[model samples]
Structure formats: C-alpha cells, structure tokens
Target: MSSPSAAESFPAHTSAASQIFTTVLSQGPLTRSEVARRAGLSAAAVTKAVRPLIEAGYLVEDVDEDARPALGRPANLVRVDGGRALFIGVKVTGDKIIGVLTDLCCRILVARYVPLAARDPKAVLGSAAELVRELLIEADGLGVRVAGLGMAVSGDVDRAEGVVRYSPFLEWRDVPLAELAAMTTGLPVTVDNDVRALTVAEQWFGAGVGLSGFALVTVGAGIGCGLVVHGKVVAGAHGVAGEIGHVAVDPAGPRCHCGNRGCVEAIASDDAIVRQVRAATGVQVADAVEAAGLAHDGVAGAREVYARAGDAIGRGIATVANLLGPERVVISGEGLAAYDLFADHIRDAFATAAFGSAARCDVQTRPLPFDEWARGAAATAIQSFIRSDANQHLRGAALTQPA
Candidate 1:
C-alpha cells in the first residue's frame, strides 16, 4: 500500500485543518469569512489553519480588485496555488488506459492515452507505468515533482487496503495495485474504485458540491454508482457501497457475469446491450455503437432493447433514492452518448417505482469528456497526498471531505 510522499507532509496539523484547506480549495477566491461559513468553523480557526498552507505556497491570496471598497483597504481572496505540486491520475478500461497529469488543485495539465491489447495484470500495469513515465517527463519539464499516482479501476476495490479485490472487466482478483504501482513508479500510489473516485471529484468541484446527500450514477461499460450520505462518501462495509450495477431489477431478466440474474449491469451495460440487441433482432451486432445504430434507425426490436435498458437503469437509480433519500442524483459516464434514446423510459420507470418524496429527487444529466474519469483519479491522489490516513479504516468512519 501507499502513503503520502516520504519526504513531505501536508502543512495541516489536524483533520479540521485539512477540511479547512479543502473548503478553500473547492470554493475559494473568497474572504476568510466565507471560508469559515462554508466549513462551519470559527474565523480564528480558519486563519490559524490557513496560515501554514499559505506559507508553504499551497495556498495564495490576492487583492479582490473588484470587491475593494472605496473607503478601506481591499480584502484578499484565498485560493489553492495549483502549481505547488503535481500528481498523476490513471483510469483503466477494458481496451485502454487514460492518464492525466494534474496540479495540486486537481486541474489537468496534460493527458495521454495508451491502448491495451491485453487485459492481464502484468500487461495492463506495464502500459500504465509507461504512461506514468511519460507524464513524469512532462512534470520534469515544468520543474515540479509528481507527489503521487492514483489509479481508478472499475470493480470491487478496497482503497484502505489498496487492493483490487475483483475486477470483472480486467479479469483480475486480489491484485495489490497500490504496492505494485508504487514499486514501478517510485511514487506513493492510491487505488480506488473508478466511480467512487469520480464521486470525490464531483463532491469537491462538480455536481455534488454543497449537497449533504447525493448519488452519482454512471452508465457505460457498467452501471456503477457513488454515494454521499451525511456529507461523506459512503464506501460501505465492503468497499461496495454503491453497487447499483449489481442490483437486481428484473427477476426474469438476463444472467449477469457475476452469476446473478437481472442485475442492472446485465441488462444495461455496453456488452449486455450488444448481446441483447443481437438476440432480439436475430442479427450479429458488433458493439454498443452498432446496437444503438439499429435503435436510432427505428428498428422496433432495437428500440425495445433500449427501452428495457432504460427501465432497468431507472429502477436502479430509484433504489438509491428510495433507500438513501438523497437530495439529488447526477447521471453521467460515456453511455450518455445514447441517452436520448432511453431518457424517457428511465424517467418513467423511476417515477413509477419511487416511493414518497424520493420521487422528487432532482435528477440531472451532465455530459463529461472521457478524460474526466482520469481527472477524478487525480483528485484521489490529491486526497492521499494531503491526508495520508483519511482512507484507512474507511469502512467504519465518516470523512466529510476527501482531504
């Protein structure tokens, strides 16, 4: 497993300090008063916490030229200095690996893609290591050291233990990804479930900002989810808090690779859709794109397949809303490319299945570039660098923020 960089420690002295820094990092360029208000801390506490961060160059302050009053000295705005340190985030998919070089603020500075011809552990790790080295050279050119590497993989991942318990798409099990990556790159590494990594980014800067309870549902190769309850991302007892993809929606539906029938992923995943489309139309479709092509062409069987997938996805989302009562649900991922085909069916199923006020939960669809998931992986690396132990024992603790 990996921890913070060996030679440096975050400037903060306590978890509260880390949280304060996080507040400034996410919603900054504000007066200290605003920082205190959002973080629910006193002004004195905010100042004390921010001092070291500013001194260390992790945070900076500037005159709010427009907000300056004519009668008094201008107030300064506090914000994270993006160039203080560098990080690398990588997202591993079935066919390729997406990597991004990011600054301390989790903003992407450079991105690279590597095709993976093999899914074995050794092959995938080799490709990722090469990509990391390429980004490291980019970091060297910028005169900054990459403090950490974060790998986001789709599967049941135990971040605290830094293990990939199981990844169906990669056909991996019990892979010590963090230790291996750290060895290969000579940098502290953080390995996390892809969707949860994305959630961390969403919670801090994307759609889930300021919401105490929300769910992020991703539709694509797999229908995954990430949940935030009581102001903390839920990893659950088994690092599977939001396995909405595995939730059974139809008792008599198709069998899933996990040996379960009617799981949401079985009916709505890219592979599942292609399989169903081929079966329904009695034609051999090549992939999800080809399957969706039939549907958009007004083929009755193809449209029915998409309708079924949408219904399943909606039911899975409703299960989260009904169970957690989140204030909002954000739908994202690559599958959004075909959202128009099944958008109505998903909403209809959710409306019919939701119980009580859960039906009122606001659901929004946000289209993000494919590289966004890699950026989320970098967010997790930023978290690991700032708070070395925040993810340890996550199954039983509540960490309100990533840092």
Candidate 2:
C-alpha cells in the first residue's frame, strides 16, 4: 500500500477533541452540551473542538426535529459523518484473510474473504495487498478515498511499532507489516494484535461500549482475552496483557505451545480439545467440529473432554476477574459452536474458583463472526487515524484536511 496523501489526513486532534469526537462517534447525534457532559469537557471546549471537525466535514450537526424551538435556533446534534471517508481492515488467520471496507464511523460497507495459500510473511502480505486492492475498488465505486488500512494478526504484535513481534500461529517474527503493506497499497497502515483490534471495536461500538470495565474472551484455535479497564484497553507494558491462555491452571496439565504445562490453552484450545478427546475416546476426532458433534451425541469420554476444556477456560477467566475485577466477560469465537457441551462446566468452575465479588461478574456469550474481526481491523485504522501521534509517517499527512 502507498502512503496516505497529505489531503486525506484525519483532523480530529488534541485529547479533548479526540475524546469529544469519540463520545459522539460512539454515542452520537447528541447536542454539543451532551457531548461536553459525556466527554467531561466544558461546553466551550466542545464547541471549540467541534468547529474544525464540522468544517472538515468529518462531523455533522443536524437540527433536532423533536426538540425544535419555534423562536430560537434548533438544538443541533453532532455526529460522525460515516460517508465522509473510508477505511479498510484485514484480519489474518492461519487459514484465511477476512477484509472489510468501512465508513468513517467503522460501519462495514463491504466484506470479502480470501483463502491464504501460505503463512509466510511475504505470501500473507501479497494476499493482503491483493485483498486491499479489491476493497479500494469498492471504495472507488462509492467515490470515497481509502484513508487508512489496519491489519490484525494473532500473537504478540506491537501496535505502537506496527510490528508483529512474534506470531506462533503464523511462525512470524519482527515483521514490519505496516511499512510493507503501506508500500504495497498507497495508504497509511496500522497493524495491531488481532484480539486488541477486536477489543477496540468492542469498546467503541460493541458489547464493551458504555462499560467502565469488561473482558472479551475468545475461544477457538486459541484462547485469547481482551481486557478493558477503566474504559481503556490495557495493552500492558510489553504489549501482552490478559494472556489468560498462558495462565497455568493445573501444574500437571498438558503442555502448551508456549512451552508451558497445564495452561488454559493447553487444555482448552481447539488443538488441545482435539488431542484430549482423541486420547480419551479412542476415536479419531479430526477437528473441533467433530469433537463437538461427538460430545453432542452422548459420547461419554468426548463429553468429558469438553468438560475439562471448559474447566480450564473458566479458571482462566476467574484469574482475569480476580485481577481486573471487570464488570463483565463476553465469551465468543468459533469454539462457542460447542458451547452447550461445556457451558455448565465453565459456569461451575468459574463459580468455584472466583473470589468474593469477582464471581458477580456477568459472563455472557456473543458470536463474533470473522467479518466482525475484519471490522475490528477497520476500527484500529480509524483509531490510528484519529490518534495520529502514534504513527509518525501517517502523522505528517494527518496534519492536512480531508478533501
């Protein structure tokens, strides 16, 4: 991707402006006073921050019909103009790359998927560039410039540096994905950990919205947790936080790919479940879907394997709750396809392991399809665009107004 042009820069600058814009973007169509109140900025500050945004066409103010004044000016509501610009996001999994074209507000306009022929960094980047080219064509049809691109991959990604430090699944290390993708496609790029990127989408528009603290735990090929504390996603000092999957629940448990024994992922990840089920049932359960089916059909040992996986997962969650005290935990992922087989066990284990008020944390499930993950990648791009200080190459271009 090529770099974003000077004219396509995102203009929402300053902490107050970003805060106000985020409040309105996430909970929008609110009056300036409401924006100030919600964002905890003075009304004057809200007005000051909103003017440039409105002038730049990034924000729009509409007169409220319900609360119109007969004599005075109508109450104008400020909101993000979703059609003003466009962004592209890509979520890379071991098997496929899911891409989404989104508006300024992170609403999905078009979604596409392509199978990955290989996991090598070069191959992945080639496929990603191709996918982005396709989305850019879609953006052209809508007559909007693609302002930025976000790529989300699993593992230890340093979003600040736009580097995939190490991805066990992809066997990648120190890949400068952002810079490479920028070269391939002509847009400023933001690369982030897949789960954290997803957490950004959740924080702004999904289950984590309006919550001061919450956790999203994904169960599938891997067990991943995204934590929101005090309304900010905790990236940890090392860019690896809320790694409940690596939390050792049983000292004598199975070995994990991370070189740990009895970690949550060792017992609960898709591969772990498959391995355990095959050993316990003496049946060739080829994959998670088959294992789930076997358990659903009252295969005795197969059900036990799911129960064990659930126990490990619940313990991992309890560890998160004990430490963070989040108000809720949203359980999701492809693994939820077999949720019925292990819901009771997860609940039981969590209840037993949780300490005091931590047990009160609401645990609910929501299935976030791959498209949402792709949308999450878009959200990160939007985030980086708004917070231009982080990416230096994008920063220079971000100073200009969008045309």
Candidate 3:
C-alpha cells in the first residue's frame, strides 16, 4: 500500500469534477450536455471536469452513433474507465469474512470467503486480513494495484473516526477498525456500517439509482437501515442515521440486545426469530433456518412468530416512509431466504401503518448474497476515492503486511 503522499492524486479533484464523474459513473455514456443536465451544472463545467478525467484515463469517450442528428455531428458519450484502478472490500460477520476485489466501477472481479474460528476482534481481524490478502493476490494476478480497502461492519460505526463505536452482533465497541485493517492489509482503508456501505452501492448501481431519496432496510442477525435524502447518503450527526432497528414498536415485546424492549430488531432479526420460534413451538430450533423450516411445514405457532417478525419489520419501514418520504424502500438481507413466509405480513402491516401519501412509497425486495455485501464495501472505497468530502480519517496506509 502506498501512503497518501505517494498515491496518485485524482485529477482536478474538485467537488464539481467529483459530481460530474459520479454522474457518468452511475448514469454513464452520456453526452456532455446530458451530464450537465443530470448534475445540474453548466455545460462549461461539465466539459472542464470531463477533460482532466479523460486525460487521467479515468474516463473515456465514444461516438454515440445511435443519437446522430440529421445535420449536426454525432454526439460523443463519456463513461468511466472501469479498469483504471482496483479496490478490496471486506464484510465481517459473526461466523465469516467475505471479501471481493473490484475495479474503479465497483464491479467484482474476484471474491473470497474465510470462516471465523472466533468472534473476538483479534480473530475477526485476522480472518479479515487473510481474506484481503487473497483478494490482493488476485488483483496482483490481474496486473492492477489495489488502491484501497473498505471494511464494512455491523454496528454504530463512526466512519469519520474509523471506529466501531458499538457492534452488538460482534460484541465490539470503540474498535479502531480502519487503522488496524490498513496495518494488516497494507492498504488505505475506509470503514463503515455494513448496511450503510450496502446503501452506497444501491444508490450508485442498484435499486436506488436515479432516485433522489430512498431507504435500504436489511433483515438478518440484526435489523438495519440506510437512508438517502436529497441525492446524498445521510450519515447522521453522530454517525448513526437510519437506525430503524432500534425504533420501538411494541412496549411488551422481547428485549433487544441494545437494551430495548420491542425494538424492531428484537422481533425481526434472525436470532430474534429463532428465539421467538423456539418459544412459540416449544422446539429448540438451532438457527433461523430451522425455525423457518418449522414455519414452512405449517406449524401454526412457528408461523405466528414469523408473522410477528414481519409485522415489526413492516412497521419499521412505515416509520421510515412517513418520516423521510423516500421515493422507494428496498427490503433485503439473508433473511429474504424466508421471504415467502412473511412477505404478506410485511406488506399488510406497512399498508396499514403508512399514513396518507407516504403509502405511495414503492416497497420492493431484492436478494443479496454475502459477496454482494462485500461489493458494497468496495463501493465505499470508490466513494472515498472520488469525493473529497468522504471520511478522511479513514483513509490511511500501512507500511507493512499483517503479522
């Protein structure tokens, strides 16, 4: 990994240039005029921004033959050069670490997974480092230098500080993950909340693209949300925005690890569902999968547990829609594997709880694999690379490989 001082600089790294580049990256291969229109910038600014990017090989232009006019010259379309740089992204879970090697366009070229022997910060970081090393080796084979590494963890992460202020699933608190990762992986690092990192990818390339406002709600070992407003990802004042999981829906419901009763996560998270299903059916289900199997087999009590979980999730979605009025809400996560059992309950509860025009918000579901979450971590690295406003403290390099 190169130090910030040694790393190549982004050409004309101004906000306008960043915005223009992002426009082409997401809604790409457009004429300069189209870039200007979409970015709400003047034509001259778009031209100016495109020049340095193209010169730096970060962007390329091609003739748009399909848009040829009767009298005028054919328009030239500008788009990102996906091969300009490579990045590594890692997602840490309780049992495993998922890693991906991606290009500047955030396309995954290689993916690797390593199961964790233990969940302690040291063990997870070691597993993460091993996974990242494998990806780095893949990038070496591709003859591309990985520019950065992004780490996504589930918790109340302080991105600006590169710290996991609290991660209940991993039982981590105030861990300086970015700095530690940089040292171990020997790459510049950016750490963030896993859900928020996923939101970055969704906003740029997935379901949230082209939308001014949207929300990503993830259901799994925990419930989490990532919110975007006014075309910007909202990282709250305390680096804790869009925490729909903690929103209490039932005062008498199960207790959450966060010390709250009836929080959405307490009812809908994977572990929560397993606990609830076991209690309802009086069968000690080993995991969410087993609990779901019981429900799928027409076990009434087990099914009710799923229904309640769905209702909690739906209420959480309604709260987001009503409060922020996002244009769309995307439901995803590993828990979507059992979507058939609870999909209806989620929709029904959302329809009932959402008020007035808020109900107009489009709700959809998308399936995401663990590797996709790792790709989201890569997106965070891409964001940091292009934007000066991204978390600065998280961007640093290590002089040596992991011990």
Ranking by lDDT: 3, 2, 1
Best by the TM-score measure? 3
lDDT of each: 0.87, 0.87, 0.88
Candidate 1, residues 165-273, lDDT tens digits: the string is 9998899999998878777777778899999999999988899888889999999999999999987889988888899999999989899988899999999999999
Pairwise TM-score winner, candidates 1 and 3: 3
**Per-residue accuracy of model 3 over 1-403 as CA lDDT, tens digit each:** 2223355556756888899999999989789999999999999999888998899899999976887888877778888999988988999988888999999989999888888899888899888887887776777677667777888999899888889999877889899898888777777788999999999999999999889999999988889899999999999988899999999999999888879899999999999999888888899999999999999999879999989988999999999999999999999999999999999999999999999999999999999999889999999988887874544443344533332
Candidate 3: misplaced stretches above 4 Å?
A: 1-5, 64-73, 394-403
TM agreement with the true structure for every prediction = 0.93, 0.95, 0.95
Clashes of 2: 9
List RMSD in Å for every model shown.
4.7, 2.7, 2.2
For residue 224, model 3's alpha carbon misses the true position, in angstroms, by 0.7
Task: Give candidate 3's total backbone clashes.
Answer: 0
Worst 10 residues of 1 by lDDT: 394-403
lDDT of 2 by residue, 287-363 (tens): 99998888989987999998899999999999999999999999988999999989999999999999999999999
Give the clashing pairs for model 3.
none
